[model samples]
Target: MYLRLENISKRFNSFVANHNISFSVDAGKIHGILGENGAGKTTLMNIISGLYQPDTGKIYLEDKPVKITSPKGAIKLGIGMVYQHFMLVPQLTVTENIIMGTENSWCLNLRQKQEEIAALSQAYGLKIDPAAQVENLPVGTQQRVEILKVLYRQAQLLILDEPTAVLTPTEVESLINILRQLAGAGKTIIFISHKLEEVINLCDTVTVLRRSKVVATTIAKEVTPQQLAELMVGREVVLQVNKSASVPGKVIVSVQNLSVANDRGIPAVSNVSFQLRAGEILGIAGVDGNGQRELADAIAGVRSIINGKIEFNRSCTRQKIGYIPEDRQKIGLVLQFSIAQNLILKAFKNLPFCHHFLLQPPAINNHAQVAMAEFDIRATGEDIKVSQLSGGNQQKVVLARELAGEPNLIIAMQPTRGLDVGATAAVHSRLLVERDRGAAILYISTELEEVMAMSDRIAVIYRGEFVAILDAEIATIEEIGLLMGRGTGGRKSAGTG
Candidate 1:
């Protein structure tokens, strides 16, 4: 075996993040670590990469027991970790970012380093421009830079956490190809992700973790995505969405030449116009930072639109719209607040949750109990802070709060992100239920598969414009993939208006 963990465990105060986890990876093979959020996958990887010391157990490389005390030590021991979030400095060029710590000389030879990095990139089939600034490059190219950085450190074993989460389908394919090439060249890879299709497609062997423990370890080809999902979630998970054909009603939301700005006040969404009808899901598919966030924020009344008109059929007030922000911790819920408080965040001023000039704890608690039961939220109590719960549970709290009065319009932005398969299924089912009850859903996600599966009509957003809109049933993944890449080939099948 190239890498092995024996009886490894980790703890954080009262919680056990990883418990007695053991797995082995052979050299020249790609191994997958599958789990939900807070399922010890990250903790195990952290221990392996020397970010955290294990409380108990041991790690062996090449059949020799080893101690990884620090990130530098891990690198010295031929281990490299590419986190879900890239670590490169956005302001610097790829060559500068990669050689920043490795080179010791005050008078650095940047041109020489760039040539070396370019040679490495070419040899490994990981094509990247070493001269390009990290922030200016596309997300896919940025990921290539990350891999090159790891390889440049002379790593034999590479650990990647959710590397494809923000990549387009084409980019994902490119990454998979690169990984396969690396494995072919005698490199060992540990892939961690909640995306089962990629895991099943890329991994030789798979380990499923649930609630800080290993549930199963098996050959990847022997199991389906559904089986892996069940193993990770410890339940029967519905992989395919079972929803009736959409019955789209009158337009619930209309945006005419909508223009919205990003946090820096620069135009992110420009001249984007679309209509969302009642009892239908209009999924906006695009790569990250392609105006999806700004559009969603503009529609949710969180950001001011610079131009165009947003018209609602039901009411002028924002209460008629239920918004689920993309970043759950940052925008969806207050981490410091209790579950009950988060659940009543939008409805706190109402009659049942609050009396005239006073607060109603009992009513709030009662509402929380019902919401918890309905949403299958697992928590110790309503008074526990939302920050204490797992990602899935925190999302449920947001859902409970947003769906309280059954708003006519739902702006769901990455609602199932960072959630387990079971939680994702639950959220999808709830959305479908709401759709059947005549709610207009503006489902915005960079997850193409999800948008394709859930939407009745799919809109391809490229560079802040709605380039194409097509019926989901007729829209193929390849067509959407091309559109997401800003290609002109797929526009023939799209509706202009």
Candidate 2:
């Protein structure tokens, strides 16, 4: 075995994040750690990468017991971790970002280091322009820069957490190929993700974790995605959405020649027109950063529309809207606030949660407890800060708060981005329930598979315009991909055509 973890356990105050989990990975093999949010996958990886020491565990490298005390120590011991969130400096060049810490103060060889890094990138098929500013490169290229950074540090064992969460399908495939090449060249990789298809496709061996315990460790080829989902969630999960044909009702929202600007005052959403009907899910499918955010925000009344009109149904008011922003940490919830407080953010001044000149604590606490139970929020207490929860749990809190009021129109932006299969299924079910209850759902996401599965009608958005609006049952993946890339209808039966 190249790496071994024995009887690992980690605790945070009253909660056990990891408990007696043991797994071994052979050298030069890609090993996958599969689990739902808060299932100890990240915690275990943190322990392995020396970000946190296990309270009770023994780590062995090359069959010899070793102690990883810190991140620098882990790097020295040939371990590196690429987190889900990129840690690149946006203003710095790729070369500068990569070589930030590893330079000699007396004799700096910047040119030589750039050449060496460039060669390493080329050798690994991780193409990145060393001189390009990090922010100028697309997300996929930035990801490659991250990989190169770790490899440049001379790490033999690479740990990646949800590496494809922000990548397009093509980028994901390219990353898989790069990982394969790395493993082929005698590098050990520990892959962590909620995405089972990628794990089943790219990894050699897999470990399923649930509630901080190792439920099973097996070869990837031996288990189906369904089996893996069941193992990770500890229950039978419906991988596909089981919904009847949507009986769309009266138009709930109408956007006429709407144009919106991004944060930089650039026209991100231009001349986009669409109608969202009650009892329907209109999915806006596009590559990331292609005006989806601006359009969604405009509809949700957050972004200012520079041109045109968005008309809500006569009965629908601003308070009747439930907006789930893509960047939940910044827009959706108050991270520093308690979960209960965040839950009541929309209705703190209204009845059931508040009265006249004061707030109502009992009603708020009871509502929060119910929301937590309904949403399956895995936390020790409801009053804890929302930031303390895992990504998926935080998303659940957003969903719980958003959907609890039974809003008429739901603007769900990337609702299931970091969620596991079971959590995704639950979210889908909740959306369907809302749709059935005559709610108009504007489902905006870059996740093609999800948009295809959940949307009643799919609209392909590219460069701020709706290229095609196709029936979900008839749209092909190729058609959507082509439209997303700014290609014309091109002899393919796409959209309403």
Clashes of each: 0, 0
Question: Which TM-score value belongs to model 1?
Answer: 0.98
Summarize candidate 2's per-residue lDDT along 34-109 as a digit string, tens digits: 9988798888988899889999989999999999999999999999899888999999999998987887788877
lDDT of each: 0.90, 0.88
Which parts of model 2 have CA positions greater than 4 angstroms off?
105-111, 335-340, 369-393, 485-497
TM-score of each predicted structure versus truth: 0.98, 0.92
Q: Model 2: what TM-score?
A: 0.92
As for candidate 1, its clashing pairs are none
Write model 1 residue lDDT over 348-392, tens digit each, in one string: 889888889588999999999999999999998999999999898
Best by lDDT: 1
